[model samples]
Target: MKSLTAGAEIDAWCTKCRMDLMHRIVAMVQSAPKRVICLTCNSEHNYRAPRTETTASGVHVRARNTGPKPSPAAARVTQKARAEKERADSWSSKTLGQAVDAFTRYAMDKSFREGELVLHSKFGEGYVDKVLEGAKISIMFRDGARTLAHRAN
Candidate 1:
């Protein structure tokens, strides 16, 4: 067998592509391929040799259940949805407009309290999540969470 180096062609299982395809050796560890890229799919990952087995009919087949893992965004959305459900229970008493009226507009020259809602000229609307001693407040916006200056007055 010839020595393998970077860019050498090899067969690997692409987790994303979920198939045994030709791959280019990316990095070698102790004369063995450590990382590779699927030429057919353009996915890069650790080199994984495909597992082959024979069935009752004596046909060669690649193994199953070697696909990509679930993405983190799904878990994050699930957690965020659960938290929003909890927050909705507490906010159930107020309508959208009523909720908006409950919070004051955010102003750089104004002070704010924690858990209060604030309308920003640029960031739209958000709820004050926390208040720090350094004139800063963590606001939870629909887009995500952010921190802004407060109590400039």
Candidate 2:
């Protein structure tokens, strides 16, 4: 087996190309390649060993796993739920003792300043977090912070 070192060319699974391609070692840890750049596509990613399986004929063949994996949509839903809970907690703490009538109704043509409270038809009550460039404003709602257009003048 050839020795491994930084800048050495080796066969690795390229995530971007989704194939075992020639890669140049960019980083090494404990004499093992930790990161590599694909020579085919010029994409940099963590090093993954090329998977091989022995057939009944005693020959090694490259194998790719085609099994069912965890759903990304389910993972996204879980993360969104956690983030929504956090945002709700923050909104509650900020809106404590504040009256509902104190919030100004949201209007695209109306101007708003940072630290002011506003009521939106779609997003409910929100606090103006920032006055952004080009008549845009970031508002923190119970769900999350959102950018909306407003009158800058």
Per-candidate clash tally: 0, 0
- Summing lDDT over every window of 10 consecutive residues in candidate 1, give the lowest-scoring window: 53-62
Residue 4's lDDT in candidate 1: 94
Q: List where candidate 2 sits over 4 angstroms from the true fold.
A: 1-86
Estimate TM-scores for all models.
Answer: 0.43, 0.43
Task: Give one digit per residue, the lDDT tens place, for model 1 in 1-153.
Answer: 888999999878878888888899999999899999999988889998774421322342233534477679988999989988766654433224655577688887788887787788887777787887688988776565688888833
lDDT of the structure predicted as candidate 1: 0.76
Candidate models: Cα lDDT each:
0.76, 0.87
With candidate 1 superimposed using the best TM-score fit, by how many Å does residue 139's alpha carbon deviate from the native? 1.1
For candidate 2, the clash count comes to: 0
Model 1 TM-score relative to the real fold: 0.43
